[model samples]
Target: MKAILPGSAADTDKPVVLGEAAEPEPAADEAVVAVEAYSVNRGETFQLDGGLERRWAGWRPGKDVAGTVIRAAADGTGPAAGTRVVAHPPAYGWAERVAVPTASLAELPDSLDAVTAAALPLAGITALRLLRAAGPLAGRRVLLTGASGGVGHYLTELAAASGAEITAVTATAERGARLLPLGAVELITSVDEAQGPYDVVFESVGGASLPAALAQLASGGQLVWFGQASREPVALNFFDFFKGPNQARITHFDYTTSDTTYGQDLTALVRLVAAGRLHPEIGSVRDWSRTADIITDLRGRNIRGNAVLTVG
Candidate 1:
């Protein structure tokens, strides 16, 4: 099996290196999945760049994966061998195969091909969980920043289906076109251009966008901050919070919060895609070997949708 790991010398040209790894075997409650494709997240780049933390030697990267079951659970409790499945592996999913517990598996049907299934788990589940926390957004005005990314795109469609009025913010006109059909009532290239007084904001871009989003919230509105794509620390003053007539609610959401509901929400997302109600927008698809370039694009915010790396 092959996997991605941090390069031995951080000062070298490449921060990540690809090499052979030991194949994993299923534990009694786990199965070995043959990874067909996987998506990239900004968080992974941070780890690879040493921005988030120190990386140990030979530590694997990646989290979201879509593939087929090659080995069934030894306990006979998971999907049988050959079942198509998507999984949020216990880290190190950049490899060709991952040993995953049944609890983390979401069975994918033929209607949902592995290529698309591979792109949904992490972003889709995060979107579902964010909307779930917003609590009945129907008829409410919502602002979604970074609306072209994986989580943003999924959040736009999901929120629209729930009847919320959506104002989506992205970085390019071509990217803006990709969001409209998903039901964004208004699309802008920058958060400064969006008309708000929004009931909720799913904010991904940090720095000024955060304060800009905070300034637009309706009384008692909520802002959900998830990512700092802008690469700047969040800086807001008293006036930013007190400028509004009424108080606004701001909360941070990440994938780990829904530990118990991870599989269930992920399964629901798969079913939604299978039913054609939700679409996982894939921004880029490349052979797994090009992972280095893929990571570069992902870190530069060049990908318009979920970026997938296909395993041969």
Candidate 2:
């Protein structure tokens, strides 16, 4: 089997190397999947940089995978061999084949192809969790920061489907416009212009945007913080935190530590995809051999929607 390994974090400009590794066998409760497609997440670069050193070992980097079940445990609790499925594993999904726990697999609907299913796991599950954390979105005023990114786009579509009024915040004019047709009722280039008092706020960009997002919450609003794309530290004033009319709650979703919760969220996401309520916007599709290029482009934030790599 072939996999990409991180050589040195110091050389961020250079691409990681692709090499051969032994193919893993399925455990008693696991399945070996012949990967057909996998998605490139923004966090892949951070993982390669040793940010997740405490959780994962080795350098194989990928989280979302869509494939066919090639081998299953003897108990047959997992999907049948040759069943199309997608999974969000805690680690090591960037290879020709991967061994994953049976519980992680979600059968891909016949209507959805491998590439699209590959694009759903991480981003879709994150969006589902955010929306659930915020409570019922029906007829509520919802504000989503970083609306142009993967999670943001899915959040926008899901919120809209629930009949929520959406105000999407993008960093650029073009990106803001790009989200309008994707269910964002209104688009703002900056958070300062957001018509506040929102019933719920989904904050994907941290740093200054965190505080700004908090300020827009309505009298009783909930805020879910998922991403730190801004690459800046968030600062909050104690007085504002205690005195704000709306009761604002901040929460972060780390999939590695919350597999049970993530699994449930993935199930809901698969249902949404199957029902045509959620569709991932794909930016680019690269071959599995071009793993380095995918990582490089993601680090630069040059790819759009969610990027996926097609494998055998």
Candidate 3:
């Protein structure tokens, strides 16, 4: 099989290169998926960068993938062989074939293509779980930051469908404009520009944005911190919480801890896509041979939404 590996540690550019991978040995509860397509994420690029002090010497970087099942789980826990599906592999999904746990794989509807299904795993699951954590969205004021990435696109649409009024924060006017059709009612350049007293806040751009978003929450409102895209630590004084919204709560969110499995959420997302309700904003698609260039585009923030690489 073929896969993507991080560039040489000495290389400052941190490019991803095509490489050979061992044939997958599926466990009793895992299926062997003949990967057709996979998506790139900003976090994976961050880990691929050699500048990071703690590097996994042979770590394979990939999370979301879609393909046909070549072999079903021996335990008969998931779909049978030949089923078309989207899967969240524990690792090494950037390959021609991958071993995916049954719990993390979902059969895709015939109406959904591999490219679109490939974009739904990580970002879509995270967005769905985040909304679940926030609870009841109907008639609520929901503020979302970093509202231009793949996760942002899904979160905006999902929250809006739940009847929540969404205020999306994006760095560029062009990027923000893309969210309007997805259901964001308001757009702003920064958290400082958001209208106050939001009922629920979905914040991902950490650093200064976290505190700013925190201050904007209404009393008893919930702020869910999901990512630190800015790569900066937050510094807050005790009095920062003493401001207007005294009872506001800031909760850290991680999708892995949620009660729902990846397959469960992926199934829901796939159904929505089949019914023309959810849209996967795939901004770029290229051959797997161009993985290096795709990583560069992701690192530079050039791709607007999800970037998919297909096996060829």
Candidate 4:
């Protein structure tokens, strides 16, 4: 089968390619999915495109996948064989087929298609986890960064549904327009421009934006740091928090290490999609082999939302 592998290091323009690899076998508690499609993530681009050293240069490189289960878990845990499911592979998912833990598999309802289901796993799970980390969002003042992103879009809608007074931040006013109905009470181009005293901040963009978000936190507020799309390190003085007027709680959430149960969150997200309440903003639904172009565009922040790749 063909899988997406890291591009040649000597080449600067292209950053990914389709490479041939043997099919994988499922473990006792895992299922092998015949991948129909998958979504390209910003973090995946960062990890593959010369950002991290590659010992296995020609290995698979996708995180989310949706397809029919060709092989059921040996333990008889998850869905039976032939069940349509969406999964978040720990790594190496960009292949004709991939194996994922049964606990992380979510059965898709007949209402949802593979293209949309493929876009949900990583981004949806992250959004759900962030909301959980931030505590109850209802009746709270929330400020969200990267409002137009894949996770950002889901976060905005979910937070809004919780009755939080949301202030969304985007890079441009044009992109801010779509976020308004998604639960954003007010829209701004940057975190520094938002009103202070927010009860919670769903921060994904780090670097300069991190300091501005921290400064705006209300007393006893929680700042959930997830992704640093800015690709910049975050640093600040002790006085900014220890002696600051509003002492906010700063928390970091990593999906791989976070205590949030994968099956639980994934099931909830799938339900939302089936109910027509959750609309995944899918962009650039293209061939999987075009991954090189997708990587280049994501690193440039040119792709506004999640880019879905149809696999077969």
Clashes of each: 0, 1, 0, 0
Lowest summed lDDT over 10 consecutive residues: which window, candidate 2?
254-263
Q: What overall lDDT, based on C-alpha atoms, would model 4 receive against the true structure?
A: 0.84
Which wins on lDDT, candidate 1 or candidate 3?
Answer: 3
Tell me the tens digit of each residue's lDDT in model 2 across 24-126: 8667888888888999887777766665462545647778999898997567777889888888776678888888888877887788888988998888887
- Pick the TM-score winner: 3
**Root-mean-square deviation per candidate:** 1.8, 2.1, 1.6, 1.8
lDDT of 3 by residue, 47-77 (tens): 7774344345557888999999999999989
Q: Residues 19-128, candidate 4: write the lDDT tens digits.
A: 78788877899899999999999887776755655446445577899999999989989999899999897777889999899988899898889999998988999888
TM for every model, in the order presented, reads 0.94, 0.92, 0.96, 0.94
Tens digits of per-residue lDDT for model 1 on 1-312?
788767744643576778888887667988899899888887877877777764455567878898988899989877999899999876778888998888888999888887798888788888888887788999999999888888888999999999999998888878868788999899888888878789998888898899988888989999988888888888889875887739797887876786465667778888899899998898889998888888888877788888998988
Off by over 4 Å in 2: 255-267
User: Relative to the true structure, how large is the alpha-carbon lDDT of every model?
Assistant: 0.84, 0.79, 0.88, 0.84
Q: In terms of TM-score, how similar is model 4 to the real structure? A: 0.94
Alpha-carbon runs more than 4 Å astray in model 4: 52-59, 258-260
Q: Tell me how candidate 3 scores on lDDT.
A: 0.88
Name the 10 consecutive residues with the lowest summed lDDT in model 4. Answer: 50-59
lDDT value, candidate 2, whole model: 0.79
